[model samples]
Target: MENYSKAVNLLTDADVIIVLAGNKMAKLEGLDLLGKGQFEQDFPKFAQKYDVHSIGDAFDQQISSWSEKWLFWSQLIEQYTNHYQPSEAMMNLLKIIGKKKYFVATSIFGHFFEQAGFNENRIFSVFGDWTLMRCSSGINHGTKDDRQVVQAFLAASKKGQNLADLVPQCSVCGQPMELNLPLNDHFYPDTDANTRFRWFLTGNEEENLVFLELGVDETSPQLFEPVIRLVQQFEPWHLIAADYPQADFPLDIQSKSAGLDADTATLIEQLDKNRDF
Candidate 1:
């Protein structure tokens, strides 16, 4: 609680609270941020591969056979980072929140931003979202997104093929589909598709913004580095961290090392109360 004062003071006026949570947090709260309902669909042998025992060992021992690491992480799940999300208690704490930019960027498919109700411009997830599925073929023939298409993709995966390629073909052109994520050499973003629909949203960097981090270990500090640099420029911006008993606060910026476990509900609640979140 060394600099809780600065963090609390800044949060009082923050326009947005960017959340960096992971799949573990999503699963704990009974939310579908990772599109868990379609987990097995996208990854055919997902559950069978990571059974209860193996999964427990992986997390407990940090041991992954070279094969499991590559096959499961490489071709199957393409991600550039490693992170575990915050629990539902964290989510409930955030849902009551509204303000600046709640960028929910996560290594696990990066849906935390949208999950917390932030706009595309405000939030950015490096890993693409499962909410969107691309076809392997091409834009026209490969996009089998609806329930029926996911089912077909699952069936195709069972036979040993990519879900993106398995999507039902385009009726007219008749071609394969691909997942929306940047799968191979040729991939592009849809300019016309706007999830915002039509809403007036705007913000300035000078405005209050809190990089509220919870349960985020030091494994991958890249995501927080940008904000850390920004604090040097805009000293008023808040960089609050609620890590476990073992976390080490940076020497420069102020941080709170609450050694308590991940529940974080009590600590966050306390911070919010003192800070007026």
Candidate 2:
């Protein structure tokens, strides 16, 4: 109760809030990449052929052809993105951050934040979003929205038609296009959004900023250490981690940080209940 009060106070008094969300947050939002939840039932072909039972394992397998790969990818994307519904925790988070100056830096590539009504400009998807596609010609030919392409493939697939020609090609180099994910060596980060996130940090250096760590774990080391260092550097900055314990943080920022040692849903629900406005 005391910890919840402190978290509420920090959020209420904060001039800006920075959310760092990761894989566990993705799981809470109904996108469990590593779990074996109906993967074989939904995607029997891929499961039998590749001997894979999870999305993460499926991604690691090299499919036989580009068309087959796109077909599989389309099914996954359509199910996750086109059919996605924001979870209760996401709604509570929105209420907790009501009208506050905020930004989201997430490693989840499913575009959950954007779909949940968060400002697109304020989000920096650290690992890139899967809904966009880039040239696979080992060159940065820019990204294009592949949602339409995904829809086309799904439509074709439903009719049992060949998905060979439906595979999207890069307009710039006429090369094959791939999902904007760091699957291999050719993945390019979103530099424009990265610049915006950096500027937001610079602008809020002196403000009473709160770093809300939501389900960040070992998978995304990039989001963890650097944020802690930033909190240590900025005297007015505070950290509220949903998963980490207070004792785990450095002694310097211990006074300003609150590690709730709970799941993201619980923390967000508490914040929503405790928030005065």
Candidate 3:
């Protein structure tokens, strides 16, 4: 009985459902979270000598933003798309979140979301797109000028090596380039991401938030705590948290701990049997 019937019932009652995404979602979307296989494939020379077991995680934990991660991965894609053919895998991941209203933190998946059909408004990307670039200068604070730099960066990335050698530079002010999230103390949230943050705070005004976190793990507390708070405040009848190797939840609800890297489609297929809507 714990199937689509109950899952859909929960969905119908939901007002402002949100998904605080994590790296698993990215991995599902063709980006390697551990920098294991493809990272090796992308740069076999480096992988051959050094252990990249934690390099990707370290970058996110250290010098890079979420967008920066994808941009880096895209560099990998540029290098190996013909040999790797990651498009289908990314496409599959995108299809899953395509219909859901969500907030993303600038993984490559964010771009795939757009490719998969999520509306611009429904998806609030907390980090500026890695697919996008702008000068890291504080001077271009708010202007049409920054977008021009962004466009130029995009255009240059088209030529291929630009992705390999692209260094960030301010258009007008000649500053270093920056990614869109708070990767460090020096990290600054961009204007759009700031606007999205404000919008996300108010996005739940309808106040019907159900978090359908498919693969969220414990790298960041920021994503997890708020949903728990929402669950407590509204007491949303039930919070259905399904994960592969699922984790614990509150006493009020039961979770479907499938296993790590569980087939999300199978879970959804089972959940949708009676979801008819």
Candidate 4:
């Protein structure tokens, strides 16, 4: 835990905090897509019909009707995103960042950062958020907030109302709309957010910044090496990872990086302790 002190010092001295969060962070907040224990219990019909035993498998299996699809999506979005509460770790992260210029690049698509009070413009959800939907026509028709759709379906399902007509469709091409996830080849990312992330890096190229990697693993491989490359490229940009050991980094940048080999919650908890807010 000696490095916990190092992390605190970095946070205190940094002008910018760049968060690279991944699925392990999502798991800490209770949205485990690959979890085997809860899928059948939470979604019996999906288990029975498709023999899918996890959320990942359920999303992979095609539902026979749009009604089923939308209903399933509604339940998931409501549980994970719409009704999400910030975890203690998230609050601690906010406190550590402390109004400093920060940008989040995360593969967690549950709207956790935004719901936790991070500015939407500074966060990029790389895998796409389920709270947003897009046209399924393999063409970019823009994204829409799917909160209204989720609410409508939740209300109808409670009353046993028909959901066929309730399924959202593209306003332009009239095709069925789907969650803004990279579930298929047709998935389109939030370009505006991507642009903003790029701009943040460019603008802060020479500033004292900490690139904090939280619970990143193979699920979000894109976040790892590229960030290390950035640390190698920029002298003022230090790297910190919750799950990676400090010795794992390249020899040259190892002095500027700290790999804690800990989980997100533990790191944030450590960062939160004995810190002035």
The model with the greatest TM-score is 2
- Between candidates 2 and 4, which one is better according to TM-score? 2
Name the runs in model 4 displaced over 4 angstroms. 274-277
Q: TM-scores of all models?
A: 0.53, 0.98, 0.65, 0.97
lDDT tens digits, residue span 1-277, model 4: 7777777777777899999999999988789999988878888877888899988998888888887898999999888887788888988898889879999999999999999999999999999999899998999999999999999999999998988999999999999999889889988888899999999999999899999999899988998879888888999999878999888899998777778899999888887895555
Which residue pairs come into collision in candidate 4? none
Give one digit per residue, the lDDT tens place, for model 2 in 41-99. 88887899999999999989999888988989999999988788999999889878888
**Model with the higher lDDT, candidate 1 or 2:** 2
Off by over 4 Å in 3: 1-5, 46-74, 77-110, 136-168, 181-184, 190-194, 197-208, 235-238, 244-247, 252-265
- Specify the highest-lDDT model's number: 2
Task: Report residue 225 deviation for candidate 3 (angstroms).
Answer: 1.7
**Sorted by TM-score, highest first, which candidate order results?**
2, 4, 3, 1
The sequence of per-residue lDDT tens digits that candidate 1 reaches over residues 1-277 is 5445555565666676655544444444333333443445544565545642332232233224422332343333222111324454655556535544465544344344455434656444444454454544554333333334544444554577654443344455554433455445434543332232112112436656566665444433655556556655665455555553324435554442223333345546666567555
lDDT of 3 by residue, 1-277 (tens): 4434455666556554455555565566555657565566655554554444434643554334433443544454343221334344334434444455555443332355555545666565544444444445554443222333444444665665444344555567766565444454444445565577568757565565556655566654555556665565554323544453334555444442112234444445555444434
Worst 10 contiguous positions by lDDT, candidate 1:
193-202
Q: Against the unseen true structure, what C-alpha lDDT does each candidate score?
A: 0.46, 0.92, 0.49, 0.89
User: What are the runs in model 1 whose C-alpha is more than 4 Å off?
Assistant: 1-6, 22-24, 27-91, 110-121, 135-148, 151-166, 169-175, 178-203, 215-220, 244-251, 255-267, 272-277
